[model samples]
Target: MEIIIGPLILVAQVALNLFWWALVISAILSWLVAFNVINTSNQFVNSVGSFLYSITEPALRPIRRFVPPLGGLDMSFIVLLLIILFVQNVLARLQYSIG
Candidate 1:
């Protein structure tokens, strides 16, 4: 069990880390666009923004349902970040225990 579960947990942790970065990037990109600091009209900018939205939106949508945005400030992404962190920590602990 340890042989299989250990690697699985590690993979899960890595996946969570990648996802956390993606969410952070998506939020920052959105802010840049909102502030007019970055022009989405550029092909690369538009493509990146669209890709980020497509990947992150599914994870964010359910969280948005309950938390919503507060005073026009969206906290869903932050909430998701917290959840991802929690899961990653748990996975690390489990991996350690198994190893």
Candidate 2:
């Protein structure tokens, strides 16, 4: 059990870390696009933006449904990040115990 569960927990922790960064990048990219700091007309910028949207939007949509944006600010991103952080911490504790 320890052999299998330990590796699985590690993988989950790594995935969560990647997801946490993805959310942060997506939020910053959205801001840049909104402010015209980065134009979607540029092929590279558009491609990255689209890719980020595709990946992050699914996770965010449900959160948005419940929380809704407040005063032109989206709190869903923050909420999602917090949830991810909590999960990561839980994984860490689990991994510690298993190992």
Per-model lDDT: 0.92, 0.91
Runs with alpha carbons beyond 4 Å of true place in candidate 2: none
Model 1 whole-model lDDT (C-alpha atoms): 0.92
* Residue lDDT tens for model 1, 1-99: 778888888788888988999999999999999999999999999999999999999999999999978899999999999999899888888877776
Each model's TM-score? 0.97, 0.96
Backbone clashes in each candidate structure, one number apiece?
A: 0, 0
TM-score of 1: 0.97
Query: What would the per-residue lDDT of candidate 2 be over residues 22-54, giving only the tens digit for each residue?
Result: 899989999999998989999998899899899
Worst 10-residue lDDT window, candidate 2: 90-99
Steric clash pairs (candidate 1): none
CA error at residue 20 for candidate 2, angstroms = 0.9
